[model samples]
Target: MTLDGFAARPLGFVGPLDLSWRDRSAAVEVVGQRITAEVTAIDLDQGLARLSMAATEDSELWAYLKPLRVGATLSGRVVSIERFGVFVALDDGPDHPVHPGVGFITIPELSWRHVERASDVVQVGQRVSCEFLQFDTWQGEARLSLRAAQPDEVPPQPKRL
Candidate 1:
């Protein structure tokens, strides 16, 4: 059976996350050059391996993030909520490369107090200040800690046995 236009094929194809798409010029510069990367995952069936390649220097957000020091208090507004984390649009920074915000706080970092959901700690459009934890190279965003910015009460001494 032959089809004239856009027919569905039985064969399936899937590939890596395609690092080249983010930095084409850098990718072109490394043609035939040997480089090492940490394997994140391997799919034998697909004959592919996801690797964490060194691209910090090639990242566009590096210029805005390089000057920042860890633990520095930064302010931003909550832009989104996700099961994994919350996205924050920093008051002063370049737009995020992949996500809607340049700052991100994982669920664990959302608070010192136990919380059920991200919404329980913060809501969208809420202004918040968080301590800079690190630069997330994968998403080109800053890893932030909201709990660090808030004062934590000293724990009471444990009772005698």
Candidate 2:
């Protein structure tokens, strides 16, 4: 495609594609043609954009992991632990472009028991299995639940006299 002798790529029917710093580049297949975009800001020093391609590719990290659905079981190494969650680098997929891992286990999902700190349930380098919860649309990461992968601990029963 060309406009005034300049190459023009069609964005297609996909809804509003908002580009942010988080989205450095992306590619979509439209009508059997692969269209790739590299989003940059206008000023180079300030990281602004005048619409130029830094690089182009047919797919991204998320594309490979797309087949995974909610409730699927996954195993990964606990790469990092934050106050909010534990980041897991999935054993079955590529590393996330921006985040530490494709899988994230939130504090509440880290354990069936009450958790005061994320570290109480998981640690860095711990290999854990988790249940896929959902794909976090904003972060483009998979949400997971370690607690769901483990059997609930049975409490002791009182003795009958």
Candidate 3:
């Protein structure tokens, strides 16, 4: 959430405003040229300051730390199911496919009890809470999970006929 400690620096000029250091890590101006240099120490005499990079290589990490946003809830109905995952329509948000990978909940991750099909546990038209596990910004795709959405319940054993 706080990038304050990361690669902070200041933008200043020794001559004309155009002859100052521009931030290349965040944005680049066509006229101004910024020389990239590692920060050595803070210049207290010259009144230099430190500003965060604003961008990070690990956005997902920050997203994970961010508190659950109010009204960010997406209501989706189960569309299809497989041994590996489930697919759902997340209203107007995005079509989320809950898989079995790092962010998905598979048959194995459902419950300690054995599960055959995801449909058996979740049916079509049944609204379930879907949370983003990981978002692929470039692909416009997100890994979702319903395991947390469903209320905890103890499955009843099959009765003898």
Candidate 4:
């Protein structure tokens, strides 16, 4: 029972041959070592996690992992705060500025009022969750936002009546 040609192919494609091709991609190094990174572009040429970064080491590590999809979830620590927004440290190095536009919920943007400082909401050393919004591989830079990262407001819980 040997068929060298297509006619020899089994019907319904049963058995291991029918199994889907599983891509055994490499894993990201250092599972526990979480370093904060500013959101860069979502898609990279080689891989999903081949993310660009403004910071040195942080972006480098992220690029290696090759996240599975675009607009994935990322986490980082807040290093600095400004009226415009907050800055998070990408594991690579250097702090990435999370502007009010893409980073955090600015005080003004949060409530339509004057926000003297971003620290009022996000303080230094605070860990934040963000989405990989936009990426610029050529520039090695990314733009992120806290407001966009989270969902619609919960309406402040009504002060418990």
Candidate 5:
């Protein structure tokens, strides 16, 4: 329940709570009511709660992704094309909670050579293998590099007359 524009959760010891941002919301249940909750950390600026729902349940995607070290290769389909980057839905993981897919490849990371456009390297519906770089904490997405998955093409040299 939300009180005074803030989300509130019942705490046994504290009773009706009156805490501020970053406070942990207690997980409590009332019989016969939809009282399912996971402890959540509040983000005041985003007006969102970061809940760990996977803790109570098994998440196959999390299970697969959690143990993947950086630089691991993963395959996915290009779900969307953007000027900034491409979003890929990984074949081995579940759909991302927020973005179109769990994987994102930036424009610069898409190719070894100069990329005039994102479409030049990858198109929508294309199957791509990318190297895992890091997790984007803010967006809860995986940062990948398509260029790293391919061999570098040698640049042409000027001919001496």
Candidate 6:
């Protein structure tokens, strides 16, 4: 919910005050600050507003991630290999805040067979293409599946109840 033309042009948020530009902006040090998100919820009691970085909120980001829907192929270079998952700096898209990459392939999603270490399957700087699983709102990551990317000759069919 963005107002087209509002008098208050928000700039940067200092310790307490949210400084704006058009009406009254700021020229503080905000060079590295470049992450956008929608105000999901406002917890007045906690004095904090929950923000989520959804593609729907960011047009350009959405455009890049739109076609890469569930089961769609997404290729990128492995930027970081962690105990929990493998992070890939996608070929295209905005940078992530916490992760070195936006694409996160968890241990379970890393392979069809059991694995010991995530590094066993992939290594840092290695190139990999995984299938999109889902968009995690809280963590702001694209949960991906490398196992699904390279399926068995005869994939198992889900049994109908």
- Model 5: which residue pairs collide? none
lDDT tens digits, residues 1-161, model 5?
Answer: 33234446523121233222122354343433432234445666655554443322335544555566799998999999988899999987887655688889999999999898999988899999999998653344678999999998757789999
| Number of the top-ranking candidate, with TM-score as the measure | 1
Cα lDDT tens digits for candidate 1, 22-100: 5644643333344444344566886555554433334556667756899899999999999898999999777765678
Tell me model 3's lDDT, rounded to 2 decimals.
0.44
Writing each residue's lDDT as its tens digit, candidate 2 over 1-161 gives 12233345532222233222255454332455533444323354643333322122213554655567888999989999998889999886776767888788899898888899998877899999999988664466789999999888647779999
Question: For every model shown, what is its TM-score relative to the native structure?
Answer: 0.64, 0.62, 0.38, 0.39, 0.59, 0.58
Instruction: Identify the runs in model 3 with alpha carbons over 4 angstroms from their true place.
Output: 1-72, 94-105, 109-113, 136-140, 154-161
lDDT of 3 by residue, 1-161 (tens): 11234444444322121121223343443443533222223458875533222213233432442333432444566665666766555555422222211223456545444678776777756677765565432222345656545555667879999
Off by over 4 Å in 2: 1-58, 154-161
Question: Residue by residue across 1-161, what tens digits does model 6's lDDT show?
Answer: 22224334442223212222112233243545654544545667655554444433445544555456788888899899888889988887677755688789999888888888998899989989999998765455678999898875456889999
When summed lDDT is taken over every stretch of 10 residues in candidate 2, the lowest stretch is 12-21
**Where does the lowest 10-residue lDDT sum fall in candidate 5?**
12-21
TM-score result, candidate 6: 0.58
Against the true structure, candidate 6 has what lDDT? 0.67
Ranking by TM-score: 1, 2, 5, 6, 4, 3
Tell me the TM-score of model 4.
0.39
Which candidate, 3 or 5, has the higher lDDT?
Answer: 5
Query: Positional deviation of 137 in candidate 4, in angstroms?
Result: 6.0
Q: Relative to the true structure, how large is the alpha-carbon lDDT of every model?
A: 0.71, 0.67, 0.44, 0.42, 0.68, 0.67
Q: Score residue 160 of candidate 5 by CA lDDT.
A: 100
Q: Model 5 compared with the native: what TM-score?
A: 0.59
lDDT of 4 by residue, 104-142 (tens): 333443223345777666778878776555553332334
